[model samples]
Each structure stands twice: as structure tokens, then as C-alpha cells.
Target: MSAPLGVIVAVRGEAEAAVVAEVDAHPRLTVVRRCADLAEAVAVARAGLGAVVVLSAQPHLDADAVAAIRAAGAGIVGVGGGPGSRLEALGIAVARSALAEAVLAAVSGPAPEFVAPPERGTAAMVAVWGSGGAPGRTTVAVNLAAEAALAGHRTILVDLDTYGASVATALGLADEAPGIAAAARAAARGEDAGALLDRHALEVAPRLRVLTGLTRAARWPEVTAPGLERLWPALRAAADVVVLDLAAPADAGASPQGPGPRRDGATLAGLAEADVVIAVGGAEPHQLVRLVHVLLDHDGPTPVVAVNRIRAAVAGPRPEDAIAAALGRHAGVTEVWPLPWDLRACDAAARDGRTLAEAAPRSPLRRAIASMAEVVVAAARAARDAPATVTD
Candidate 1:
């Protein structure tokens, strides 16, 4: 005969004894341990003493803890919490009544899966990141998104630069309305993130929307990885192409507040979830060095290098060729998109709160950005249409 499935009950209050009693009555299940708290339950799970942990809803229980417990080879069955509750949000909840029957159903099959609704359309996420030397990441992102929108792709320009968020300012929109942060907060509350995004995203042009970033740098903590984790899928469902203008840091390590939100959470999350990553860098010698470091340090998706402001004065004769050669030699980057110096066009666009195409259609920079956008959109479409792979 098959052995009874080992179950660990970690719930508190009266629910604990009730759950234990319910499990004991089951012939195919047995209560192996009654953990005092989440930590003890986690330890027991890590040691493989239980196949499933019956946990109670607690404020301290979060995605990280749930992930650790699950990674330790134990499935979770949350015993409490109603709609929109943390437990429900974790995708492991079983109703308080008929607990044993629910547990049996959950254990008999696979763990409850949280599959986001099929997106309205496949949207490719393009993340524009830099190595902190101000390689005009935002400028590149804004123009590319504009070009994509002009090309008939519904595009969203998300300013996730927590340090100095200027997408709203550059687009001449009022910063009073909370954009990405508000959507994130809604996602964290287990609300409709796509609906919130639709309400918060400002339509700058016909097909182009902008999700502004933090108004104050100190508000970085409000945009956590967990919140963005929920927001990303909603973003993809809302648009055809999502362009993320990330902050300079790729990996800022742990938060100074310890175990809490890190300032670079947005950037890291964007990079991790991106379908295409554009590493922007200036054409200057020093900027080239920093760009190489940025490219080398990046371990996520393969990035396309964009050398901005390729001027002969800054990068020597045939600046594009020179920059490409240097990046290839140093960073082993073969494919490089060179954007020329168009200070007049860039300044005009900034002053008018418009894109280069709108401000100066004839600008060399705009033309180059148009070409790059074509490539980006094609890549995004290809990625979206590609078949998903599964591994054991």
C-alpha cells in the first residue's frame, strides 16, 4: 500500500488543532509536524520532512518566504484569508471550511497555478539601460517608443528611473498624477493592474502612452520587485510594445534598509523581464569605457549596443566605425547602432515637449532612431510569436 502523504501544520489559533484533527482523520494523509512559526516550517520543509506545509495567513508571509518554502521542495496550502487577502494573492489558499477536502484536492493534483489572463495581444518589453555615465538612455528610449508608435505599434514608454525621473518633464506632462508607482501599488493590493495602468497611462500621442516614474527619488521603496512582478504582465497585455527607461544601476545589491526594498529594484526587474535590452552609451572615449563595463556586467538578455552622439570631434574620424570597432574589440559587441550628434534637434524636441520626429522630422538623429525602432519592433514581434519552451 502507498504511504500517507506527510503534512506539516503551521497554523496558529484554533485553526491549528482543527487542521491537525482533520488531517489525522484522513487515511491518505498524516500530520508529521506542527511548526510554531513560519521559520520553523521553512526549516522543516528544507529538511524534506513534509511534502506540504499547511500555513495560516500572516502579514509576515510574503513572496520571498513562499518562494523559499516552495524551493525547499514543499507545497503550501494557505488555510485562511479572503478575497484580495495576502494568502489569496499567493495562489495557495484553500477555503477555511472543508479544509481537509480542499487539502486533499490540492495535494492530489498539482499546486494551484497562477496564470495571468491571456494578454489582449503579445507585447514585447524593451529595456533601455546604461552604466551610470548618463549615456542618454531616456532620450533613446523616448524616441524609439515614439518611432514605434508612429509605425503603428501601440507603445508604452515607462520611466522606471527612480533616481531622476524626467520622462514626464521631457514629455511636458504634469507630474502630479502617480503613474507607474500607482499601478504598482494597485498590483500589490491584488487589484486589476491592467485597469489601473489604463487609467494611469497618459496618452501623449495616438498610439504612444507614457507611464511616468517616481516624482521624488525617496519614493523608490514604493516600487518594489514584488509589485512590479505583478505589473509586468499587465503592461504586456495593455500594449504592443513596452519600452522601459531604466535607472543606471543594473545590480545594486541588497537594500540599505536591510531585507526591504532596494532602490534599483525597478531597473533589475525591468532587465529581468525584458524581451530586448538596449544598452545605450555615449561615443566619447570615457563613455565608451563605461559602456564596455556596462555591457560586460550585464548577465541577462543579450543587449543591442547603441552608441549615441557619434560625432567626429568626440570619437575621431568615421566615429561610428571607430566606436563599433572599439566595442567589438573590448566588449565583443558586433552589432552596433550609431546615433549621430543632433543637439539642435534634441534641444528643439525637449523645449517643445515633443519627439524628434515631431520637432524635426529631417533630423539625422530622428532618422537613425526610426531605423532602430524598426529593428526593435521586428525583434519584439518575433519574440512574442516564438513558441514557449518548457523544461523538466
Candidate 2:
């Protein structure tokens, strides 16, 4: 005869005894472990000691924990929770009244199928990417999003920087907000991402919404590439223009959690999903070289390169010309946008927790960003008007 399926029961209270008795009596279901709590259940699941986990409704049983358990290759069946409970969102749930029948069916049942939402008028996603030396990536992303919003496009600025997420601080929003992490978790759970964003996204300005990044750098694993893959389509459906403030694209292969999600997963994911990539770089010679390398290595969409803090001290006598010649010679990039260095204006905006347009509307840097925003708006309009290609 075939071996019985391994089951881990984590139900609490008096109901636990009845559930265990029922499972033990089943011929096809074998109780491998009776976990004291969700943590133990998760650990046991991670160890691959159980094929199915029968759990109770616990306050800590969130989507992250559910994802971790599923990632460990275990099926979940909740006992005692009624319809519309948290368990329903996590996975399969059965009533305690039908313990034996429900447990058996849950363990032996075929996997449920997930239907993707029908394609609609998806938004244009723009990724603001830069190299390692802090080339004003966040600054550009924030300002560009603000400009887009000012121009009447519904814009969402997502901070996907796993290394250092400072969009919240820059925009004067609370840093501890759930932001993109919560959205990713919802996406992982197959929840309606647009509805979730409506609840979690912070509206700092008219027509502009902000989804902040990680609360802790160590929590990078929560934002996996696969999770973001599910998230991108939903994000596209949520806004007219999605601005992603991404981390530097340096490959940090497999994190400490083995060959799972890496540190740079967010950056890579954003780049892949972006309709246009705004590659930002400092105007200094060395920074310019790094930008050239970035341009050369990128094989995706044609990037709109913007050189920030352009000055005679860094780019020599004629800053704009020097930048143009260098980029043209090294990276074959002919056209370039130069954002003049206006430290006073930038400092005032940063101090006041406002975008360039709001704090220093007349700043030369603000004008440059506004012009870039116009270009982005035009690109989005063209893309939306283009014919949608069908795939097999």
C-alpha cells in the first residue's frame, strides 16, 4: 500500500484534541507533528517534515508567514475559521464540524487554479536606475512623479531600493509604513492589488501616490522577483504612470537564505517591467564613466539618460558639451539631458520635504525635470495608442 500523507496540525485550544483524533484515525492522513504555534509550524514546514499543515486562526498568521510555509512546499488547511476569515485569504479552510471529511478532502484534493485578471488599459512603468555612487536616482524619481501628477496623470512612485529606501524621508512620509512590502505580500496571496494599494498607498499630493520601500534592509527577501512579477501587472492596472525608484543593479547572487530571492531582485524586476528606463548619473568624469558602462550593459529599452549636478568644476569649461561628447564617444549615446547644479534650491526642497516644483519652482533643475516629464508623458501616450500584440 502507499504511504499516508504527512500532516502537521497547529490548531489551538480544545478543538486541537478533536482534530488530532480525527487525523490519527484517518487511513490516508498521518499526523507527523503537532506544532505548538505558527512559528513551530513554519519551522517544521521549512524543514520539509510535513506535506500538509492544518492550522488554526492566529493573529500572527499573515500573508508573509503563509508565503514562507508555501515556499517550503507544504499545503495549508485551516480549521474552525468561517467564511471570509484570514484563513480564506491564506489558503484552504474547513470547518471544525466536518473535521474528518474536510481534513481528508483538503489533504487529498487537487491544487486550486489561479486565474490572472483580464488585460485592460495597463499603465506605463518607468524605472529610475543609477549606478553605486548615489547619482540622485530618488531625487529624479520623486520630481518626475510629481511633474507627471501635476500634468494630470495618476502617478504612483514606488521605492524598490532594498539597500537604502529613503523616498519616505524625502517626501516627509512615515518611514515605517507598510508600503511596497504589503503590496508585494498581497500580490503573493493573489489579492486584488489595486484595492490593496488604495488602502496602503500614501497620497502626498494631488494625483500622486507613494508606495514606500522596505522598513528594514534585512527584510529584502519579502520582495522577491516572482512576487514583483505578479505585482507589476497589477501596478500597471492601478495607475496611469508608475515610477519605480530602483536600487543599483549590481548582482548580489543568492542571499543567505540559499538560492532563493537575492538582494538585487527588486532592481532587476523593476528594470524588466519598465516601459522606459531613466538612467541617472553624476556629471563627474568617473561617475560619467560608470554611467557609460551602465548604458553599454543595458540591452533593454532605449534609456533616457539624465546627468545630474552638471557644473564647470566637474565637466570642465563647457559642462553640457563635455557631457555630450563623453557619452557619445563612450556609450554611443548622442542625446543627453543636463540638470544644472543648484545646491541651494535642492537643499531648500529637501529641507522642506517637497518636490522641486513645489519648493523651488523656478529652479533650473526643476525646469529640466519638468521637460523630462513632458517627454515621459508623450512616450506613455504613444505607447497607449499603439496596437496591442496578441501572444499565444
| lDDT of each candidate versus the true structure | 0.83, 0.82
Clashes of 2: 0
Off by over 4 Å in 2: 91-121, 172-200, 212-239, 250-274, 292-303, 316-336, 378-392
| Candidate 1 lDDT by residue in tens digits, 141-222 | 9999999999998899999998899899888899877998888766665566778888999999989999998989888877
Residue 304 local lDDT, model 2: 88
Taking the tens digit of each residue's C-alpha lDDT, what string does model 2 give over 165-232?
98998888887899999888766665666677888899999999999999898898778775676667
Q: TM-score for all predictions? A: 0.80, 0.77
Task: Give the worst 10-residue stretch by lDDT in candidate 1.
Answer: 250-259
| Global CA lDDT computed for model 1 | 0.83
lDDT of 2 at 16: 91
Residue 1 deviation, candidate 1, in Å?
Answer: 19
lDDT of predicted model 2: 0.82
Candidate 2 versus the native: TM-score? Answer: 0.77
